[model samples]
Target: MPRRRPNGVGLEVSALGLGCMGMSQTYGVPDDRESIATIHRALERGCFFFDTAESYGPFVNEELLGRALRGRREEAVIATKFGWEYEGTRRGALNSKPEHIRRVVDECLGRLKTDRIDVLYQHRVDLEVPIEEVAGAVGELIQAGKVLHFGLSEAGAGTIARAHEVCPVALLQTEYSLWERHIEQEILPAIRERGIGLVAYSPLGRGFLTSTALPAEEYPESDYRRHDPRFQGDNFTANTAAASVVREVAARREVTPAQIALAWLLHRGEDIVPIPGTKRRVTLEENLAAVDVVLDAEDLRRLDEALPPEAVAGTRYPEAVMHMNGR
Candidate 1:
């Protein structure tokens, strides 16, 4: 397995990480047996970094990851987030109050069946709570040895600086792919300046770049992508066409479009890690193999021209959800 140290933190992880969110909710139904098998496959293949969040499945995703890592926890680098409030399975509101952060960490530790979280992130910028306070709360956890590293998701450049000042942030989890390049203009530079690494989620454009994306209407209402503007109506058609460049490159290189997309992110820098979510062992193997798909300068140029920021169709999220990003 290829190993990478984000921001020179001396914390080494597999070049490709496993995103465990899909196993419990979103995209489709839950399949415990398949998901556990997939996790075992990932470990066998040397892909150990696993990401989940409290809001995912409103709680079940952590439990699922906990169960999967049961006897073999020592071999994995677990990363999970907390920032949202939940009423059973339904999401309620954003809550990152200092007290809430402390309480959530305990609950997450319990759910994950681990004494420490390898990396703990604030899922989103809690506008209700100041970034420094959130950082301080996480800092205390780090001091207490409950979390090994701290991360932020979808935070602005200024917010990242503030949080890092309070507690050195090890990574920033956000959306980045051939179709989404908003961070390149500002956030990327800021993190690079501070020597912080990036954890690129939705690295496959939510599976759209893989040429297997279904139209929004095809998804059940229970699926979160149904409400995502990028998957709806004309936007889906336009985005699919725009992402064809990935397929073109894949055909030329004799690799899957998903591999092409992941390879593009991997080539961006050693500090950047892409966590592509999958519940099937076959897809997991395919995603992990992307580390070997080398895209030369010409291939990189073609991909850049193919999916420029303007080429994408809709906002990454609906209004309410979009409001929470880059805060």
Candidate 2:
């Protein structure tokens, strides 16, 4: 795996990183053994960047990654987030207060089984706690040697600018797959102006761009896809048809649709790094190999036109989840 510098400060990571959320929750049952093996395989393949959040599995995901990186922690760059409040094991409302941010990083350090976090994200913008305060809190942590870099997830453009003013944002984690292009208009340009790298989550459109995607109803009630707007009703049918362009392009290149989807993002810019999540080693290998699947001008054009922002139906998230994006 090749490395790319997402920021001018020389933060280099694998071209394609592994997203560790699915290993603990959302997509399916927890597979601790396999998830650990997948994480090891990623490191073995030279992909050392792994993404997880404090809210994921309400805290178990960080613990799981901690266990996986136990002896080999020196070879990985771990990125975890905070912002959501937790009462015991249950997650509560968004709370990015300065105190909350410091407390979460301390707790996350123990759960992650590491002394310092490679990258710390806000998880989601907290409207109540000003962005400057959040950034300042993270800045203090960075100065104290608890955090190496600062990032924001799903934050608005103005908020990003304001936060960066307080503390330089090294990366912005957001959903920016083919099906999710809402950030291109304002967010991308704003971050690019500041030279903040993009850490694209859901680079596979939550599996819709892949061949294994099933209807929303097909997923278990506990799965997040069950409530995703793009996976429901007529939107599923329409989105499926729109995603066919990926299959067509994959067929032409003799590569998997997932690879095509990831390759497209790679071609978008060197500043963009897509962290596609998977608990299985086989799937992990397939996603990492996307770095080698080159997309030409024609391929890029066809993909962009096939899935325009308007062509895809339904909001990226359900109404309740969309409420958090206001920041």
Candidate 3:
């Protein structure tokens, strides 16, 4: 039930948002009934910041979210993104051209069943189209009253600066967790200086920080983690070992490791809002509980020492996907 304001954007949301990606794709099979139920439970718990994207399930995820929010729209803040060129679930090249951005926003509005998007982000920077143009396109949408705020995902500092100059970016969604701290080097400072809030995705190391995570090989081929380097081979072992610190702290605090991991993010700054994805009510409740798990200075120091930026084992993404991060 805790609330956070992203970089003084004047937009407040639940400290922990619901990441609606895995409910429709990537992690495993789709479970619409449960996904909707989880979203409802999130609302009941006062966790009203829900994140989705046009690329998630290529389109179905937004539809599912729309269905979930049908009668309760005003109670939740919806955040979704656009960037990838996808048809159904078959993804193609990245496209953020002015025309494309306009097209995508219209479709997203339809799928979301909403007139205004609480926050609309460019999923990934489109090198083909200048960042300024991307920002301008979103600015136009804002003027049209289609988008309430603008955001960028996995964008480098330079890109963020350029875009914000054209139009103030309310938030920056990127991969940030105990294992992935690359943003701290430059991106984080830049966004903070610009008063841009951060939305931390994969805050639990994509479930690696949780006890339920299995070796890469144990995941089904359809699971994205099966191909993620951090979850594969020796890297998985090393990362799992690194995450033991989370377990130790959780045991001492009498909290779940997931809570420990999420609380660590919450401790970083109020400017940060983490959207941990889940398709079940149980996991959603557990993640929401992180808002209450306070990490004092000593606990913060121990966690930082335990999983220092360099300590994490593999790159956060594979080579091909890594290239698209705009960092």
What TM-score would every model get versus the actual structure?
0.98, 0.99, 0.98
Q: What is the lDDT of residue 166 in candidate 2?
A: 93
Provide the lDDT at 289 for model 2.
93
lDDT of 3 at 304: 94
Answer with 1 or 2, whichever has the higher lDDT.
2
The lDDT of model 2 is 0.93
Error of 3 at 256 (Å): 0.6
Q: Rank the candidates by TM-score, best first.
A: 2, 3, 1
TM-score, model 3 to reference? 0.98
Model 2 residue-pair collision total: 0
Compute the lDDT of residue 38 as modeled in candidate 2: 97
For model 2, give the 10-residue run with minimal summed lDDT: 318-327
Root-mean-square deviation of Cα positions for candidate 2 versus the true structure, in angstroms: 0.8
lDDT of 2 by residue, 87-194 (tens): 898888989999889899999999999999999999988889889999999999999999999999999999999999999999999998989998888999999999
Alpha-carbon runs more than 4 Å astray in model 1: none
Against the true structure, what is every candidate's RMSD?
1.0, 0.8, 0.9
- lDDT by residue for model 3 over 1-327, one digit each (tens)? 988898766889999999999998879898999999999999999999999999888888999999999999999999999998876678899899999999999999999999999999999888899999999999999999999999999998999999999999999999999889989989999999999999999988889888898888999999999999899999989888888989999998999999998999998898999999999999999999888998888888888998898998888888877898855
